[model samples]
Target: MSVFMISQLLIVIAICFDLMSFQFKQKRMIVTCLSVSVLLTSIHFALLAQWTAAALMLLAAVRYIVTIFSYSKRLMFLFLAANLVLTVVTFGGLTSLFSFAGGSLQTIASFSKSDQRLRQIMMVGISFWLVNHVLAGSPMAVMMESLFIGSNLVGYYRFYGMKLSS
Candidate 1:
């Protein structure tokens, strides 16, 4: 298969990981799945030669792994700072802003104590990623983010019933 096709396939696999993340009630399980998804997404972006997106994804993957162990405010700040540095280093076009915003929000969400709050924040972050995927010309990634939003909503409903408020 061509590189483009391989990248698309990788996105599909990443989508599965992301979708699985929201189904579980435990935060660790969710982060574990997200870590895999982010790592796979990083590889997908690398295959597409979207270096900025790939680098951000790598940072997000590391953040998710650390979050699984401890939701430290210090670590959150460190990751946010690292994200800024990566954005500056990658320094592509306007599209990089979306990745940075998404990554920052996700990093903050990782530190939240409540699952609902995490999901809510993640929805916003995923929306940013959706925009980035559109601007970056990755249709499958866009679809993945869209599905992730829906899945998050469903997961919320499954866990907390119909109430949207935390």
Candidate 2:
């Protein structure tokens, strides 16, 4: 395998950590694992030479780390503001619109207290990100997000039963 593909393997590890994060009942524990995954994912993006994705992942890591300490609405708004600023700064035409949408959804998700709501919003964000990754030619990111969606579906079914209610 090429060295790039080897670097992409980090995303797989990060995805595993992401799936494991939801298994925890405690919010802090879940966010902690998510923070670790995002950190690894940031490194993966950096390796792929995708500066925008790297920056977004780093910011997401910060968001998760802060979530472990507090779930304040103020913080969510801050994430919203940051995501907007970052999206503008990193704009690369229509192709990057998916990243903007995904980040926006993530910031919105941060405002919710319910795990079900969180998962739902995050799934949508992941879908946006999956499209962005495909367009950006990041195979690992596309693969990770696809698996993330599936994992989230399983978690949702297991936790919420048949109803998709939050």
Candidate 3:
């Protein structure tokens, strides 16, 4: 599979792990998913030649180890901080997509209300695919789509300043 496909797969699996955790409220499964996600991240870094993968993997491993051992809030805080850094850095370039994608959020949010765990998975998975798309697609394409649709979800709307909601 392509690196993009592999990354999206990792993202789906990661969100699945998180969804499972939300359903059962178990930390271990989430950590396991985090481990797999981190491993994929390392490979992604090698593929992309970014230096953050090592640090991410280390943080993931540490979070897994501590969570497995049933750690204290301090450790959890550390994990949360690492997650914060990962969240912003990983999604930085795609923020424009999210900022624009907000309009479709009502529809998406309905799913979350239908079932809380399902909501998280959909949100994470779609965001992952979109982030991958925005980052990997041609800059020209991304910009054109974003401007055309007033959102990153270009194909979902009509042409000429029209929208699904109108």
**TM-scores, in order shown?**
0.97, 0.89, 0.38
Best by lDDT: 1
| Tens digits of lDDT, candidate 2, 40-159 | 887876776666666777898899777767779888888878877876787776546787788678767755677788788889898888887888787877888888788778877878
| Candidate 1 lDDT tens digits, 38-157 | 999999999988878899999888888898788789989999999999999987887899989999999999888788889989998999999999998999999999989999999999
- Judging by TM-score, tell me the better candidate of 2 and 3: 2
Worst 10 contiguous positions by lDDT, candidate 3: 151-160
The C-alpha local distance difference test score for the whole of candidate 2 amounts to 0.77
lDDT score, residue 26, model 2?
Answer: 66
Off by over 4 Å in 1: none
**Residue pairs in collision within model 3:** none
Error of 2 at 43 (Å): 1.8
Best-fitting candidate, scored by TM-score = 1
